[model samples]
Target chain A: MTRKHLSTWGAVIFIAAIPIVIAANSPLLQWRDPVYIAGGFAGIIAMALLLFQPLLAAGRLPGLSLAVARRVHRWLGAALILSVFAHIGGLWITSPPDVVDALLFRSPTPFAIWGVIAMWALIATAILALARKRFRQNLRYWRAAHSALAIVIVSTTAAHAVMIEGAMGTMSKAALSGALCVALLVALNDLRVWKRTRPGRGITTD
Target chain B: MTKLHMNRRTLIASSGAVLATGVAGGLAPARAQSLAPTQSMRGGSNNYRPGAPIVERIGGGGFWMTGTVRRAGDGAPLSGQRIQIWAHTTEGHERDWHSHGATLTDANGVFRLEMPQIVPAFGQPHGHLAYDSEEFETVFLRPVMSSARDTTLEAHFVLQPA
Candidate 1:
């Protein structure tokens, strides 16, 4: 295989193996509750998707064009939303009071607070993305709002995953979370989304 | 050129700040919360069941949990039935938390488990016990509270046949 194809396939395999390895070692398997297992896996998948987002947005993935990356990024975003829904829904069915506590930000679990914040931020970002065309006249404002929400999503989700003790192994989870934060920081830096520009220059290419 | 250098330095500094905040926030010590049991805290239904009773013994201990397995309808002792028990101990590390074991009820349908002293951290002093058998629905009893002064806790299970 060509070197580029080899790299692409290697990356895909490596990414796919993360959750497989984590699920294999997870305590969820011992619990033997399908709903709980599904919820755990969904959460893992969402974190994995979050790792992909910045890479795609920053056009860092090898063998993929900017157009393909953007398309994949959009589709992945939708998949992330679905995964979050499944994760929360499964947890809700198993424990409605805990879910309510989480939503109300009164849960004693530190992870729940961060997870709820991230979920709401993710929903807001999705809504803003869907309503992009409505803000045609104020594209700059839309982009700024979108970027801010993206920051919240990444930050809070990373916090949520790191604090939880279940599912993903400690070292592997830490490594993935570290890589995610670095990728996001690099993407935001490259995009220069926060850089101040002349008043009339408008939004720079991202 | 100096302005460009300053901006680069600013970006690096801001990135470091953000990373520091994230890492610190994630690693913050978990605050203790009151032990409020939730529905989900009760183990899921998939692990529940009833079977013939058998006797099984666990460690000799700080606290004792003894119980009998019987049919809900007829009150007949379930002989040779399997019971699974797990609990958090006082000395266990946060990462290495929880103790577990399994045993069967004797001909008279009784089983006993011994637990080490449990120190309460995230919640109250409690443990989970499950009954698994082919003939009846699975039963999960969680957060079976124990007291520091009390040495023995009684936990009985009456199962409904499938």
Candidate 2:
């Protein structure tokens, strides 16, 4: 096979291996609490999705076209929302008081607070994405709003995952979270989402 | 294409920096306590009973909390010991909350308690379990934090002889 084909397959294998390795190393198997396990898996899925979000946005996946990457990005965003719901919902079922504490911003655990912030930011971003058509008249504002929310989601989720001591092994989890943070930041920077656009440089005025 | 390559290079370099910083920062011991503060479940009710080991799975739709009861010193199985569990759920913790139940250990001193759909009660994700038997000192395991991922929790209880 060609080098490009090898690279594509290598990327695919690496991505697939990450979660499998994480799950294998997780104490979840030893603990065996169904609700807790579900919640943990949801958190892991959300983290895994974070890795894809920026890559998809930047059209970085080796074998995928830009159009496909954008489409995948949208779908992944939705999946991320669902994963967060599952994560929080499972936790809620296991302990409503803790969930309430986190939601109320009174949880003593910094991880819970960060997770709550990321969850809300993710929800907000989803809502904004869904309402993209309605914001057609002000595309720049919409883009800015979306990008800001994205940043919040990436940063807060990274913080949330890093702070938790459960499920994912520390080294692997940190690596994943750090890679996600950097990837999103780099993608945003490269796309110039964080910078002001030049007056005549593809600035859409509706 | 050249622009894409440069972007990839930048992404790699930045990711490396982030990995180094994150590993350093993330590995630091968490300042916050790992376990949530224990809460009391005593005021609710005492459903303790001693009979032919109530072995039925109590409630449906929640995770299973299973474990073995053993002597603290010799590690021998403490069979026929009554194990009781109770926790708050999405449903309010009114009197006669059905989440509360009891069961006896099998011949091997193993027991399984099916938790109901749980809800946080007092700023913690916890449940209460106790080993109440005539021969053994009453051991109350309160505010046992729920696991995050495992479908069934294996929580062993070691009791002191009364």
The digit string of per-residue lDDT tens for model 2 on A68-110 reads: 8888989999899899999889877765655777899866567
Provide the interface RMSD of candidate 2 in angstroms, 1 decimal place: 9.9
Q: What is the TM-score (0 to 1) of chain A in model 2?
A: 0.87
**CAPRI-style grade of the A/B interface in model 2:** incorrect
Q: Write the per-residue lDDT of candidate 1 for residues B55-132, one digit (tens) a residue.
A: 343333576677878775456778888777655454342222234556777899898777665443222344557765
Fraction of true contacts retained by every candidate, in order, equals 0.00, 0.03
> Residue A55, candidate 1: how far off, in angstroms?
1.6
lDDT of 2 at A139: 72
Error of 2 at B75 (Å): 37
TM-score (chain A only) for the predictions, listed in order: 0.87, 0.87
